[model samples]
Target: MATYAIGDLQGCLSPLVQLLEQIQYHPEHDTLWFAGDLINRGTESLETLRFIKSLGDRVKIVLGNHDLHLLAVSHGFGKLKRGDTLAEILTARDRDELMDWLRKQPLYHYDESLNTVMTHAGIPPCWDLHKTQTLANEVENILQSDRVDDFFATMYGNTPDKWSDELTGLDRLRTITNYLTRMRFCDENSRLDLESKEGVNTAIKGYAPWFNYPTKVPHDCHIVFGHWAALEGKTQQARIHALDTGCVWGGSLTALRLEDKQRFSTPCTLNRKKT
Candidate 1:
């Protein structure tokens, strides 16, 4: 049985189906790992959510920033931006069940057997694997608890742009969430530069992609992430894989088979629509 790690779906179910067919996936024997952003922007958000949810144990998913935005919008916390195609999902009959499943999804997924870790975005250089898991759980518990509304109320900021052990409450949770979901570039000191969305070369002065930042603690496991579609599935590092190929932005949908690191892709057939 093979395991495939797919990039952001962003509500593009057709491409995902095509990619799975190309890989000749057998759900009974094979497993799928999604880099998240499962819904939003693309045309079929509702269908994508239902299909992925139906996969059950055959698939694993982490949460992306867009996914969180959907959660917040569902609860009247966030406004729908101009190009958002999430209305179908919000109006679905199973909207409650889908959103509940999404909120409970972890922000980080680590597979000991594969020796790989997956997140929607890069992990901060300051966090080792153990610390990463611990911090992820902290937010996960809050998201799945009675205080979830409180967390969502304060989850939309970029303050405290750096990680610190002394940070508490919403500040701490927000920082962790950003690093795992929205982070792309950071300074040598691990201060996240959230504004720079361009490719690696366009990083602001004194900043570099989060994966390139220096770390006091080292993590040996491979990292698989999907947020920066600008990279187009290229990190130039063997262990660091960028799976998001911008399928929602008229690029190709990609997947990487874990056992042999084989890459598979299907061209996006959706109309070129910006989000």
Candidate 2:
């Protein structure tokens, strides 16, 4: 059996369908690991969510910022932004089932056989693989519980930009969520500079892409992540894989077969639509 990890879908089901065809995906023998952002931005948010949900056990998904945002909006926490296309999902009859299934997804997925870890955003340098899993579990636990509202209430902030064991309650969960979902630029100390979203070149003096710093991640462990589309699927580190090629922004949808590291892609029709 083989496994493939795909980049952010962001509601672009067409490119995803094309990429799956290009990969010659066989659900019976292949497992698909999605890099999250499965909805929002493009025109088919509702359809995309349904399609991915229909995959059932054949796929693994990690929640991204947009995915979390969709949850928050559904819970009446956040408002839809300018380019957001989540209204269809918000009003769909099966939204409850879809959102329930979504919140149950983990924030990070690790496959020991492949020696790979998948997260929507890269792991924080300070947190080793074990600690990353522990923290991610904290958010996942809350996301699937009745306390989920507490998470969304305290979710939208960039303060307390570093990690510490002393952090408690929603702050602790939010810190873990931010690193796993929205992180981009961070320092060696894991101090996140949440404002910067540009490419590595504009990384603001003390900060750099999360992958640039010396991380506690094992030398042999591969990290497959999405969320920073500005990188355009390029990271100098061999073990660090960036799969988000900005398909929702008129770029392309990409998938990496973990067995051979072969990439399959399809051009998106949405040409630079201000994502």
* lDDT, candidates in the order shown: 0.90, 0.91
Query: Residue 206 error for model 2, in Å?
Result: 0.9
TM-score of each: 0.97, 0.97
Clashes of each: 0, 0
**Model 2 lDDT tens row, 47-102:** 89999999899999999999999999999998899988888998899999998999
Q: In model 2, where do residues sit more than 4 Å from their true spots? A: 271-275
Cα lDDT of model 1 by residue, 84-105, tens digit: 9888888888899998999889
Checking candidate 2 for backbone clashes, the offending pairs are none
Residue range with the least summed lDDT across 10 consecutive positions in model 2: 266-275
